[model samples]
Target: MSTERPRIVIAGGGLAGLSLSLALKQALGDAIEVAMCDPALKRDPHGDKRAYAIAASARRMLETLHIWDAVADKAQPIRDMVITDSRLQDPVRPTFLTFAGEVEEGEPFAHMVAGGDLTAALVESCRNAGVALMPTSVETFSAHPGGIDVVTNGGGITLRACLLVAADGARSRLREQAGISWISWPYRQSAIVATILHARDHEGRAVEHFLPAGPFAILPLKPETLPDGRIQHRSSIVWTERSEEVPHLLDAHTEDLLDELERRFGLQLGELSFETKPQAFPLSFGVARRFTAERLALLGDAAHVIHPIAGQGLNLGLHDAAALAEIVVEALRLGRDPGSADVLDDYERARRADITAMGLMTDGLNRLFSNDALPVRLVRDLGLGLVDRMPGLKKFFIREAAGLAGGTAPRLLRGEAL
Candidate 1:
């Protein structure tokens, strides 16, 4: 009905929000207006000491957006992965499964990138692409017949948009304001995340040790050379532990903490020391009852929060960005309302199954391995061993983990321009 370009307002500037803005602007040029609001955007991204595993498909989406090259040199390709299940006191932890890490020839399933680096790159890319970057966050919003009206808190700015996206994360205020019901439960486990500098190189290998408490992941990172010509190998640790035990671990003296870390890390990587202070995050599983309502849509943790057991949390959000971008771009190109119910429904349908499956899978895996029950341990280990022995099954899983197995993969994820 109207020939005016659609305005889309995103309520967060995290990875999902920033990437979505870049995708929309890069795809539609001046045909659409994209604005992202997040107070964190005003802060320096270098303070974030986290790292993420970027699936191959998500990497493709970033490449399509021309954002990957900025951080490519800093990314560490995961050449292989090893999984083991054992108790902390065990003298030897036997590997139950091993993955070659390549989903396609010469293409690793994933790469590890520092959070700050990726965020900085995305923010710069969004600005360079002409997407409006709002330093204030969306405090409230309401949908009207023509579009949605957004109100920013401290900025005192009221903006109108054809659509409003809630990327505010697991504790999304916008989702609540939109009357979206969220189902969630705490795992009573917290993951201690930190970067460790080791004497020997990791050789681009990632390892996951499933202990009675939870999965301890050692994700490889690109080696750093020191001033004295020493190569410093690094890895990002996601050590899951009982929730009540986290505070003690975090408050423990450096030597005490290092002792605990060494018990699980073993001597494979040589002496280990913290490259960053450890931070703990309480784990949880959450999903919205509906991904969209009228002109409102949920993205990233705003829609779902899955366990990081499989390291697929960020990948799922990137997939959402790609899918939503494609749907909106197509709808607008055809002269339809990008925020219309039909367009929103298309995005919901495309992502619902994938998100649900991943949520359930990670939840199940965490429950299965986060215990000392002999029966459960034997069963899961056997299952892992069996699957590890099946080349076809493992290959299929590799593709799935790379976010390239499904038929509904978006063009951006497929490394194609919108």
Candidate 2:
């Protein structure tokens, strides 16, 4: 019997790639050979100020892989979420919806974790699991009949793998090389992301204020305490604005920016101080025409991109990682080519519907809310009110947010073995 293990190469070492690496390592052990390469190995992960709202399903997967413990102290459980809608300067920002985010008693449906902290944990877990980490960027790759040849930029080293996965960001060179078409359109909106130190405690409450421009989210973070026994509160902001106005907002003086922020931020949290310089990103919605091509598969942003209005962008990518890892491991156990047409097809089929639905829903919501048109605003506010009144329906939406809406939840999602 041949003792050689089937090899898989993953490009991009962000959340999706790292999570997939850990999942494969836990499930397949030494039965499979895995390698991941990224150009960012030398950089410090702490520079990333963004945070993610990890769904329950994703939390379960991370726990199974033994990753959540390292980040537990930095993660804040979101006990409740409040949604309000009104004109930007309106006298009142009326609450249109509210969600008690615990799917079960004593457990939150989601938790807020800093992007830097999550990446650091995943990188360490990957290192300890014996997954080879190549610190060079992929220069190019060519797909052959049975495998792929990947060349790194720095050392020009050539490596081969039976399957190559792309977890690269929105502009994925590998996906482009594989000739996968993408349907995407810019929303003419952008978001300002930053961390803030506030005077009052958030108490695990997250707020989404819907103004004429877009959704402004204030997500609670773990508290910081001073030596004098005073607790300093913090929150992450995702403030959306008109695309044309983003540059001005980002370039304005610090105090000027704070003045604008205070307008939407209200006085609920008392005084606020910037913990990091604000960063802005243009918003867009996109999905690949097909998730798999030949021996290659797309995960995370390479597969789809959605508006941050729903906070499901990263969770969707995590879903892809979980699904693809499960399918690949099953194929290996069956003594089948993990990258074969049959296996790839099954992976695509499993992810397509869920991804497509999410993409459409996010696109629709962005279009529905990110405007000042009187008729549209009235209709959407009414819709929100209606959804708020439906108890069973609200619970269903909560489950969806918990990442438990669809059929046959994945094993890792259920905190079960593969």
C-alpha positional error of residue 187 in candidate 1 after TM-score superposition, expressed in Å: 0.4
Best by TM-score: 1
lDDT of each: 0.93, 0.89
Model 2, global lDDT = 0.89
Tens-place lDDT digits, model 1, residues 1-418: 3677779999999898898999999989998899999999789977677999999999998998998999999999999999999999999999999999899899999999999999999999999999999889899998977889999997689988999999999999999999999999999999999999998989999999999999999999999888999888999999999999999999999999999999999899999999999999999999999999979999999999999999999999999999999999999989899888988999999999999999999999899999799998899999999999999999999898899886769999999999
* lDDT tens per residue, model 2, 208-262: 9988889999999999888999998999999999989999988898899899999
| TM-score for each model | 0.99, 0.98
Runs with alpha carbons beyond 4 Å of true place in candidate 2: 1-3
User: Per-prediction RMSD in angstroms?
Assistant: 0.9, 1.3
